[model samples]
Target: MVFYGVSNFITLFLLFLLPLHSALPPTTTVQINSNSILVALLDSHYTELAELVEKALLLQKLEEAVGNHNITIFAPRNQALERDLDPEFKRFLLEPRNLRSLQTLLMSHILPSRIASHHWPPTHLHHHTLSNHRLHLTTNPTGAKTVDSAEILKPDDVIRPDGVIHGIQRLIIPRSVQEDFNRRRNLRDISAILPEGAPEVDPRTNRLKKPAPVPAGAPPVLPIYDALAPGPSLAPAPAPGPGGPRHHFNGERQVKDFIQTLLHYGGYNEMADILVNLTSLATEMGRLVSEGYVLTVLAPNDEAMAKLTTDQLSEPGAPEQIIYYHIIPEYQTEESMYNAVRRFGKISYDTLRLPHKVVAQESDGSVKFGHGDSSAYLFDPDIYTDGRISVQGIDGVLLPPEEENEDESSTPIRRVKTPLVKVASKPRRGKLLQLACSMVGSFGRVCS
Candidate 1:
């Protein structure tokens, strides 16, 4: 009897232990490679730096340098690119004719040898960059470090066997390049007064002939407003015009024109569709725009919207809620955003959706939104702004923090029902228990 009892106990133990072993997920192994550091940066939310490396085609060069020599990179956070750099300068670098300048600017951020924070000396030191430009580094008595004029905000952001990254507070522009850039920009500004293809002046009246009137059905022309112009402040919506539709204004046509422009020209077809078909938001947005109410839209690009699962979008009222989250009920032009960042370091504003707020942070020069692990940058800022309506392009969809928390906490509880079995004897009861245990073990293993 003692032997039988011991055997039963052992059998039960083996049954539980075997299932657990089989149910555990297999461990996954990731192979580190040349691009591993870059991947790490991306995983750590350093997307802006990753993009610059890819755009300048410096990844291979950085990788090769890592293999042969110690490499250090002065990476500018996304905010730097967005809000810090001069708009004209950024445009100039992107121009096809300025590829060499673009490469040079990118290379100037890299040092041939690794220089960790501890290695930095109190006195000014000279380091050679890949661009062949000599960068002057200095550490002050207060322990503030700078490369050229750019302050080192974060040191040893990433230190690995291959390379290291230091986050800078500003972009480094070499003196020679800066001088040339300024000269070119000045000439360009001067030339704007007399455009190359502009029509000859009518000296008789000192004014050109009026252009032909636009067709009745033609879209309204979108006026380009200066980004530096004062942004709109919160105010009561205007009452409807006499005998006009309740929500309609004389500016409604312009609002429609803008939406159409976004659809056909701005490459926001998916967003446009959501506005037009998914909800009555397009009409509502138009009304808001026409009423001169200030609004800023965190417009997600088509690719970002494409990442959503069918279920996420198909649920009732989900699409509208998501759209509401994207629209900030304030006029936030690029200049305003930059000023906000400079003044407060960060800004938080209520979205169209009640109680949900979007957080904005200015880093380096760019602006990033949301917070913690769930955040995205304004990949394309100042897409379209006219004091009353501002549309900025974002790279990802943002979920409200409360919604995310609720989702994490509310897991579905599943219950299994077993068929009732009538046992006639002790042997039958024992057999049923064994069968039930085996079925449960199998099911548990499968679920796990």
Candidate 2:
């Protein structure tokens, strides 16, 4: 019995020693090179974020830094980047001249230590980012956590020996960059780009004066009123006079004038700024207008534009798409729209930007576009109606068909039906008498 017990003990000791000898080399190697695992995760799951890091030339710095410190990255998702970033700001960061600013912006998302979501405190905590900027963290009563203005969408996405990654919903713009953007947007002089040499103006109409002596073999000058006349008018409007004041109708100048007029007198400065600075659509529109192409634009008021969220406007090419959706290829006036409704009961026009159509119908003597719950009306129609361009003021912004469908699907529908009831009592003498009684009662209540 003693011999057998000793033999079993020897076998157990050898088994333990064998595992120790085999596992020592690999375990130490994995611990030393574990930082690459986080890099791999970024390349695989967070490609967009990875690309931004590479563009800023931050991958080398990250590699060197990861070896020494425990890092935490507030990485934005691809969809979030596509949908929430301001296009102008994104372009600014990608510019070669702004490499330092771009690096600072990227480094601002990294913290020196691992900070998991569960480690977040109830009260606000100020943490310094790698760029030496202060990042504020707050947790609301409802358990929503935010880092600066950006919300943390997914936390603890990757946990490695060297670091962790938390997905955020928006790009965290550094305060300095944001201030710079604001200053540039507000202070930039746009008048410097206006066309030189003012054309002679007609005192009565405030329009450019026509030059005398029409050239032979040139197209006749058609009256602006003729194009505004009612009927099936599908042909392009007559081209503006060459070498006359009409030549001053430079597309860039007209666009500038249109935007400036709205900003100065129409209380649409916010919308105007958005068009000028945010998207290239303003230039495109100006080019088309300069080429003497007739166009109609349904301009949304500032109040209507204020209702749009960052997510709604941040998608790639979203601003241009929205602006294009508002423009109609054909020049349309209020009179023409009314006449069309009278003749055909409705009118359809193609938009300049998308493969979408804007359908108009007369409702209570006013023109409304789109259908059902997606309809928008011209609250201030015929704001500007020259021969070449017509501007109508709309009450709401129009969404594309796909967006409308998504909106409808997400909204809850509550249908309530009114039930009919039969009464045994005799009816009143007449409908006019009942109306008179109700009006008298309403007046009495008002007086009281």
Candidate 3:
């Protein structure tokens, strides 16, 4: 009898919980349709926003919300995210621990209900975001629509039966996100509990003792000439070590690019061939560039190069001597050269060839290089200029003063005309040729 009474009491207790269990609502999963607004948003031109939404992992939650009511999304332009967004803030949002903050920031741009441009109120009105943040919608006096601080660049940019998207000029940042970013970025405040003191001051200078930070875009303190390798006359300089010094520019690539540009720019093929094919000057130039040296090449056109005789190129190292006279150690463009010549009557530029300087002057409203019979005019202003390597095209080849004088005086007829200036019975070859031959002979190869 006691067991039957206890069993009846247990049955009555179970019967009491049945109504409570039946009163609760059933749970159902909402399936996203192929033609849904969510799909449209993902496939739309607003790819940046879609990527953020997916990264925030709000798709499932948003799908459930969409199943219940329509939503309005304010999308920023792609450039705003790619270029205008602060790198630090973007990094903060992408951090694993800041996932909630990212979701909140993205959700703040969305409204729970459809609010198209036409549906927007004429006066200022506040709407609740999916994140439960308030967004102020208003129209300016000029009749342009705005949400929060961003102006609507395109109204009703993407419209679906269930939702609408408006294109905005920039991102709409929330106060919470701003505060979170500030709280995270401002390290001084977080470490304020630790004792702090004033910066150390120097007794002699009466200024902060710490070394001054280098300013952006300041030129390097070291001069280009100091970086050049020293060697015997006409001998190849050894390559610079990797860890020797800090390089401010990629000199080797710049030199190669300038040479290639000369080849492609037309009318400079001869100059390019002599530097790259006929000699190892191209490699030497690359090394010079790699060591932080800048070079300005006064390239002669093919027509001018064709004027050279067999004797000019036949001697050992003659090609190098001719080319060296054309290469100025300083970086100069057409504009700088023209301006310098215009300011000063004439300017003499130092070349790689030792003790030789090329003179420039303004003539016929253009910069003219060299002088007298062998002078060349700056035909092409700037063929290539990349901070380190500059190439300018000229109409004629430039010969050194000594070479010009020797050519004029070496002639028998000229010597007969002026018998006072005694000319040598046997002509002497260039010192450069002798040095080149000696260097080449060391390697058991004939230079000529």
Candidate 4:
């Protein structure tokens, strides 16, 4: 008994420490002259950015003392604070809600050593933030160097012997991360990185893949209209049968009902477009109905839905889209999700409502949907109906898998969140919508 107890304790200790230890990352050591940089940061009255820098510095307990460590610091200037408290900027990078996540992000700004000039990790390349995120960086080596996809308005302000500095046009942040931006981004344009084209990209090459041709006998029109176009009035999805759109909902009528149960129980009224947007499922549904493939639908509850804005909720296509994005056309459950727990393990599936993905958390047995608003989980499984779709309710909203940009091919670093809804459907509520994005963390579930 004593031997067994000791062994179990050791194993438990190792398990507890493993993640924090493994996440320990590379640190940059640059020799510099400005010893006062540390002092300036530690001062309680220093600027917010300076305070953030100080907090970061204190946590690391650096031997460099700002100048001692040869370094480059991308420091924001006085003019940048004109809108510090604004909701957009404040809300940017707000999730992960802790210092470790923040540290990871702040560290992404540092490279292995003091890079004297504008050179690599890749010019126009995006790097992973310490927060385990990817931020867009653009370098105009010819015109002037820039990072974080922002213009360096005043480049290379040396902090004398301590480090180098650059004044950027906007606050630099990780992509799909808007915690800070919401606090200060009243001036930002909504279309900065709205890449043109469909979200599907080839997994192997990281390029956009052509939508597969509709199956040989499939319907002529895309289901974007048929599956999603509202009926004259609301009606329960038809039973699993020859009638209705053969590519049954959520991969089955049961999945649809499962969602209705979630909404009904959570006090919501309808579903989103997760169902109609999955081209592949639409294709498969046309061919096999429910007899093929296991499917799982991660559902969003009313509380999560409540965060969306009236404009987002009232947008003409909003309701349809919410349903489509939330429902997967196939069936997958907690067991499968837990099995596939690493980067390559996640599998994307099509849905009557939206594109869906299932990712696993290896340590915890619980399986949550892959994105924002999807933190919720099923109360129980085995939802059955005349409709064939089987579903389990989750607390948060479901998000589509992150598809890569064709031009960027196979880059390991990618944005955590991708916006799915166009602004036309979302009302401009300033920061509330962006701030609320923490719950969804991107993946277009920031509906309001």
Best by TM-score: 3
Which runs of model 4 end up more than 4 angstroms from their true locations? 1-46, 55-60, 63-68, 76-97, 116-122, 125-136, 140-145, 172-350, 353-448
| TM-score attained by model 3 | 0.41
Worst 10 residues of 2 by lDDT: 225-234
RMSD of every prediction: 36.4, 27.2, 22.8, 30.4
Off by over 4 Å in 1: 1-251, 403-448
Instruction: Summarize candidate 1's per-residue lDDT along 11-90 as a digit string, tens digits.
Output: 99999899899999996444447455555655655676676667767666666665667678888878888887667778
**Higher-scoring candidate on lDDT, 2 or 3:** 3
lDDT of 4 at 339: 59
- Evaluate residue 212 in candidate 2 and report its C-alpha lDDT on the 0 to 100 scale: 49
lDDT of 4: 0.45
What's the lDDT of the predicted structure labeled candidate 1?
A: 0.68
Model 3 lDDT tens row, 1-448: 9999999999999999999889999889998888788999999999999999999999999998899999999999999898988787799999988999999999999999999988988999999999999998998889999887688999999899889999999887775775566546434332543322223335566444443344322332344343344423444433232212334344555566667567535568899899889987888777766544678999999999999999999988789889888989888998888899999989999987777899999999998888889999999877776666788899999998874565455446633464577766875768799889888788776544
Model 2 scores a C-alpha lDDT of 0.69
- Misplaced by over 4 Å in model 3 are 1-232, 235-246, 403-448
C-alpha TM-score for every candidate: 0.36, 0.37, 0.41, 0.32
Candidate lDDT (C-alpha), each: 0.68, 0.69, 0.78, 0.45
Ranking by lDDT: 3, 2, 1, 4
State which candidate has the highest lDDT: 3
| Candidate 4 per-residue C-alpha lDDT over 1-448 given as tens digits, one digit per residue, 9 for 90 to 100 | 9999999999999999999898999667754323544443344232665656555543344344343454544555545544643343344434334454345545555432344445534456655433445545565557666665446676554443444555555555442223233212322322332322222334566443454543322322222323232332334432222222222222333333334344323233333333434222333333333322333445554566666678755765565555556656444555445455543444455555423444434334455455554444544443322223445555565545567777876657666996788556666667787777765776465564
Lowest-scoring 10 consecutive residues by lDDT in candidate 4?
240-249
